[model samples]
Target: MTDQPVTYSADSRLASIWSAAAASWLPPITLILAIVVAWEAAVRIFSISSFIIPAPTEVAKSLVAQWDTLMQATLVTAGEILFGFVVSVVVGIAIALIIVRFDWLGRALYPLVVLFQNVPKVALAPIFILWFGYGLAPKIGLILVIAFFPVTLSMLAGMKSVDHSLLLLMNSVGASRTQILFRILVPHSLPSLMAGTKIAATLSVIGAIVGEFAGASDGLGYIIQFASTQLDTALVFAALLLVSVLGVAFYYAAEILERIVVPWRPKFNDA
Candidate 1:
């Protein structure tokens, strides 16, 4: 009898954890299953040709049959995405810092930075291919351009949003510029930077895939393009599903990393 309360408490804790997890995950899982069922029913009812629109089962079969090729392509695409994302974050943060530190430079150059982003990335891909060849170089180059804008823009906003009064206090304390930057500015801007990372993460995935679509010897995008030409819509759908999963994975990775970096951020109750 003495140990019963402790056992009950442990059981209650386990139950609460499962409840929280289900509350978070169950709706999306249920929704996806519902959509899959509806999709299957619609295809059957209409007798839709697989080439016109693959049934979910057809896509599943394609996924299984092409798993080896798909896995290799996924790895190639993941490398491109990760390389571009890391570089973009570093380059974007550096550029934002430089612009922030040099007030006159920021005024003169920030508009140009914004202007560069307006140029269509698709248009630039060919030029990058010409310059960098058909290797990962061209893909990474394009991804960098496509993904860096949001990080730089968001970081600038966060740094600029810091309280002016706090800057004055730091200035009065004989704090070095480096000290001010890392200790005050960086910390203050972290949340905004993290928000940018999420955007950049997804963009990295998009840019790599799109780059491949434009022209690549490998990667999921290449598979998608080839499948389309052959009218293998099932394979195309499988590739698209893989790309979606990759994007979602990258986005959630950023979200999880943000938690580690900014543990103070609050979590809302799923209930």
Candidate 2:
């Protein structure tokens, strides 16, 4: 009798797990299917020309036809995003640490940071091209500029959120500033850091594409420009899909990293 109840309970738990998984995945899958069907039907029913708007099937064909070229461009753009995002994280953390350590410096430099943050990165692309040329340097520079602010802001918020009593307690124990930063502040700020990273991921992609738009030998943005000029609307759509995938991939990567680094983060399950 005891074994029977235990086995039944285990089965119920497994069923619940499966149900939750399905619930989480079903809505997005259904929405994507609906969009694809509506798009295809609208194009066929309206006698819409493929030049103006390619149907989902037409986009799929272009994706297959130009897979090699698109993949090459994607690889270049991915390298720029990854390299620049990593640099931004490092620089952002350093800036946040400095801000937390010195109140006077943070106050003085924060306005300057915010000022530069508001400057449209695309508007400065020409200057970057003139200065850094058509190489990856300009794209990397743009990505760094666009992505770092959120990280710095998030880290500062997280550190500031730490309890004042904890700080006083540490001071009473003669803990050094460096020790407090590493031992207390860094750990506390990790969740906020990851949240900023997720935001930065999408911005980094935009920055890279905008940089490519100004001047690039090759990238998804370049492909989009060339395809549009050639009236290959399907190809443009195909490139756009790849760009979306890249942005989603980076965002999910940040989410996964957060789960690994902050396993104790709160979860909100539906009632």
Candidate 3:
């Protein structure tokens, strides 16, 4: 007798679909809603002044009212972060490649990387300002320094972690180092690279803001600084809210890109 494939019933299919959807989105959505509700309740229950901690409603109104200026600052900050991040990625990957390919280079230069990474970036802000002379350059340089390490370390580790078996096989087949690196090492390392990129995405914002705090006369950080000095806590909170939204948006954007790039990652299981 021929074996017939067993098919799930329609009810089972519906249940599985709903379960998958819930597993994918329920946790984060619930947590966000809960936090918003709790925040609103706390401000009301304690009779907290807006200056102390603006209500979510107040923040929302401020967001709408200051959308134009806030948005302009956001765009400027985004531009610096994006430009600096891209520069870091390119330079970091190139450095990683050089180190991985040449043991002497790694031994000679990797320690310097460690030294640089160890230095508190904020401490270097004044030096950077002196060197780059305010404007966009200092911010760009700061962001690059902040973002570069993750990419470098992650790429180096990823490149070096290529399977020994694969390398041996390539050697036996007389595959050139370049071919092996391009065909095997890079593909294997993409996940790690993506992880570094995700980290760099967040750090980039911090670096830009810090740089602004040190020198720049524009950007959200400048707004934050000015607001704080004037005791405009609502405006500070408004700028902070903008920064938070930017970080979330940028991180999730990187996450979406990672998923697209790494489609082999397993999805939620509904069974």
Candidate 4:
């Protein structure tokens, strides 16, 4: 008289998974398409000058026409962002570890870190260019400076947030400081680290652009600046679109890495 248990077939399970994925992606895609359509329509209906605001079609055409130049600029910017982000991750994590391991160091340095972060990053760009010259070094330096704070702060918070009870339990077991740090603190801090990484990724792009704006012969920021002088609004929009795409790509790449590294945690949106 027991009821039979329900079981989903493999095909049905896959179909359900795909259905859920589609449901998640559909709204955003649809909205973007609608916006593009509206934008195109508005420009046409109002006879808006492309110099003022390029239509989506005009932007798309410019993107294709200038693909070579745009791609090279994008690559220059991407390289700066990638290098800067890597340096930030390494240096930030190292600083966080030192801060957590040494109370005196944390007390001595954390305030300075916060104060430096509060300083206008844009102002520093000029100084960096002056010191490092108008080369990739300055751009990478700017990105590192801009991206470093978030990761360090997030890791510090995560390390400090570790449950005292857990620490006591580990201590009772005679766990060494290194073991406790590796086994507990680092694992617990992953979510916060990933969160900071996502922020850093977006900021890295901004820092690169700012550096380029201050002084650069290449990169998307340079392209935008050059186009502005010519009043080539469509090219400006096209370059901007590339920057937006790069930022989104960098963000999602970090998200994917977080998922791979910390599979136990829920996806960011889910949480």
Model 3 deviation from native, Cα RMSD in Å: 4.3
Give one digit per residue, the lDDT tens place, for model 2 in 1-271.
4555333477876787789889999999999999999999999999899989999999999999999999999999999989988888888888899888888997888888889989987798889999999999999898888899999999988988999999999999999998999999999998888889888888889989998998998999999988999999999999999999999999888888888988878644422
Best by lDDT: 4
Relative to the unseen true structure, what is the C-alpha lDDT of residue 13 in candidate 2, on a scale of 0 to 100? Answer: 68
| Model 1 lDDT-worst window of ten | 1-10
CA deviation > 4 Å runs, candidate 2: 1-17, 269-271
lDDT of 4 by residue, 69-158 (tens): 999999999998999998888889998988777779978988898999998888899999999999999998999889999999998888
Alpha carbon deviation, residue 183, candidate 1 (Å): 1.5
| Cα displacement (Å) at residue 193, model 1 | 0.3
Counting only residues 3 or more apart in sequence or on different chains, how many pairs clash (N, Cα, C under 3 Å) in candidate 2? 0
Candidate 1 residue lDDT tens string, 57-156 = 9999999999999999999999999999999999899889888777899788789888998999878888888888889998988889999999999888
What digit string (tens of lDDT, one per residue) describes model 3 on residues 163-259? 8998999999899877877788877877888889899889988998999899877889988998888877778888998898888888888889889
- Model 4: how far residue 34 lies from native, Å: 1.3
Instruction: Output the lDDT of residue 10, model 4.
Output: 93
Question: What ranges in model 1 sit over 4 Å off?
Answer: 1-18, 268-271
**Please, what is the TM-score per model?**
0.91, 0.92, 0.86, 0.92
Off by over 4 Å in 4: 1-16, 268-271
Q: Order the candidates by lDDT, highest first — what do you get? A: 4, 1, 2, 3
lDDT of each: 0.90, 0.90, 0.86, 0.91
Location of the lowest summed lDDT over 10 successive residues in candidate 4: 262-271
Better of 3 and 4 by TM-score: 4
CA deviation > 4 Å runs, candidate 3:
1-21, 264-271
